[model samples]
Target: MATKYAMLARTSRLQSVASTEELEEATTELQNFTVAAGTLIKVASEQSAPTDDLQVFVYDPVLREPNTTRKYQCAQDSLLPVSDDLWPFIVSIPEPNRRLQLVQDSSRCNWLYTAMPGDVVSVPARYFDRDDFRLFECIICYIGPVPEIHPVGYFFGLELLDDVQSPQTADISFTRKYFECDADAAIFITADRILPTPLPQDEEIESANEAPESSWSLTNFIQNTVDSIRASLPL
Candidate 1:
């Protein structure tokens, strides 16, 4: 009977994945679904036809390919509130193919993001000091959300362009590929641990000319991010 609700739709299990084909199959069971844990849904206050269930959409920036919406039905009791410091940051990422740097957040949270191929990035020595690695720069040659590594985030497949070597390939979780590079030169990282690398001066000038000034300045960026996350919620 509730009207508007904001919730994170999640699987009770460690993972729940279904092939789009399997999902389309009439006989596919409810246990076989693609709604992984931590997916976000906002109720628009509309009751679905016949079943009288509340209609909603399950979306995870980490799971959806190319970013699409999946409509779902659920009882009012099934929903839960959304609260997290990282989701707002995830929603604010700029376009794919931008340069980035990976870091290990002291907060113990790595990030989950939907990255496309051809993005350039780097990792600093400070991040991996405990490990033998010193430093490296890399380009994101491939990206995929499926074969979910963890419901927490999207992993990357990096092709290292620096002196640091790797022992992984372009794969994730082994069962699937997190952003993998080559077995000879690969390392996987989550979004929370990554930061964008700034573009060069010449390219920055060209980008400025290509687009009008945006409101992403120091003061405005925080304001805009807050506004965007607030507007996105159904609360």
Candidate 2:
């Protein structure tokens, strides 16, 4: 988020002159004191008004003057103050976000993420095959397939958060890193698998209500993932 700011001229400060009677007496030079250069300040808009003289809390901390805010007159010299553009505001412009766009499943069904990147969700099985693992929560760190790999995109690049380990670490090599994580913490997978698994707590509820069936032993997990990738492609 961009904060509103006012930039002061670096070379100058508030200029002062002697009294009106002294101004009538002196004809040549004006008396002044050296002051610090201008400061870029951030302030609460409610405390200030957009006028020629703007009141703001500048970094002008003084030894005796404890109160912080000060009012100063400013003009750009580019135009007349009455005709100048004042009180303008910045607005956010809309852009396309792929996560909001629909993704197709292995069976050509459409789906969307219930939890986005940086949020945890359970996948039926992760990238590699190891018998003891089943549904577990992994944070979705990315939303596209591995680069230069087949079926161009539509995979979740995950950062495995559980005690269970995997061979991947966002990439196979240093030059190909897709996301940052520990050396063996990442795995990329299709969106299809995230839908079928229940989170561990949800799994416990399922076990309490019904006979516990074997979640994917996934001896063929890699092959299954590959098949899903191919199935998602146009024939």
The most accurate candidate by TM-score is 1
What's each prediction's clash count?
23, 0
Off by over 4 Å in 1: 1-114, 131-135, 145-152, 167-181, 206-235
> How would you encode candidate 1's per-residue C-alpha lDDT over 74-168 as one tens digit per residue?
55555553335434333222221110111123232332343456767776645556564555677776544333444433455677777655534
Q: TM-scores of the models, in the given order?
A: 0.36, 0.32
Q: State the TM-score for model 2.
A: 0.32
How close is each model in CA RMSD to the real structure?
17.5, 22.0
**lDDT by residue for model 2 (152-172), tens:** 334566777788665554544
Residue pairs clashing, model 2: none
